[model samples]
Target: MDKTLHYLFDPLCGWCYGAAPAVSGLLESGGVSLELLPTGLFSGEGARPLDDAFAAYAWSNDQRIERLTGQRFSEKYRDRILGDRRQLFDSGPATVALTAVSLTEPARELEALEAIQHARYVDGNDVISLATLADLLRALGLDDAAAKLSHPDAELLGANQARMSRAQALMREFGARGVPTLIVGSGAKRQLLDHAAAYSNPRALISQLEAA
Candidate 1:
């Protein structure tokens, strides 16, 4: 039987970005059917401006993530994303873009997600912008998804909400508190994997997933 893993994450979340490498490792190990669930934690009403207080807090949290996970949270990201006040720190557009990817090419959704995360944390690009996301998707050879994201239709928007609602429902069911929650197994026999291992030790995280 294929081991099912539910990755509950928010695209704009720093910890979720920190957990990417470990999640990728888990996926690459094979024999696992993984689902990428965007929880919409930092979207809609959860979205906020890039104010000074939040920026400092974000950088501090980001540095901790970098120290623990070895994920690069670049200076450009600090300066451009958190430093620049014009951009709103929102994940709705990026989540919608991922939904578009899911609609067009389901298998490549993870790839699209990684690209979006990299754009924000490494490349320091405006991930909230539809144009930017479209360009990034096109760069990944996902022109169809890019086009959908560039001009999102009703179906895409509805699917985006549905996907997030499902993820959030799973979280509530499992009593999961935050982003990057990993729920393994299937049906009535689900197991919530440890979140600490994702940042502290990815190898251990993968082993946990395999065992689950």
Candidate 2:
């Protein structure tokens, strides 16, 4: 039987940013089909202000993630993204952007997610804004996705809603509580890979997926 991997993550998640390398490794390895699922953990009703306490906590956690995964968390992001209180730390726009890519350019969905993450976490861009997300999609040559943003239809909304629901249901099934979760295999034989290995060791993660 063919093997597949379902990656559940939120774009605003720091750990998800850390797990990017390993996810990339899996995509490049060509041993298993990879599906990117956005959980919408930080979107819609879950959105909240990036208050000082949350900002500090997020930074501290981000530092640990950087140490573990060698991903960069820059001062620019800390100052511009975490420090700015004018905007809410909502993942709705980014999630919609990824869904747009998935609908229009399925093959490039992963790339679009990586670029959106990079725009927020690395370049300190406001990815939560539709305009900013459209620009990011365009920069990635995803003009179809960019166009969809200007005039999203029921199909796009339904797809995004269904993806979020599926991701949430999967999390419940696995008793998982956070982003960057991985489910390998499929149907009754599927298994949840250890989330820790996604950042601590990419090769080990690949091996685990292969074994599953």
lDDT of each: 0.91, 0.90
Candidate 2 whole-model C-alpha lDDT, 0 to 1: 0.90
Model 2 residue runs over 4 Å out of place are 186-188
Give the per-residue lDDT digits (tens) of candidate 2, residues 1-212: 36788999999999999999998887677767878899999999999999999899999999999999999998889999999988798999899889999999998998898888888888999998999999989988999999998678898889999999999999999999998999987556889999798888789988887778
Off by over 4 Å in 1: none
lDDT of 1 at 18: 92
Give per-residue lDDT, candidate 1, residue 73.
Answer: 97
Best by lDDT: 1
Error of 1 at 196 (Å): 1.1
Clashing pairs in 1: none
TM-score of 1: 0.97
**Native-referenced Cα lDDT, model 1:** 0.91
The sequence of per-residue lDDT tens digits that candidate 1 reaches over residues 98-204 is 99999999999988999999999999999999999999999999999998988888999999999999999999998999998999985668899998899988899
Estimate the Cα RMSD of every predicted model relative to the unseen true structure: 1.1, 1.2
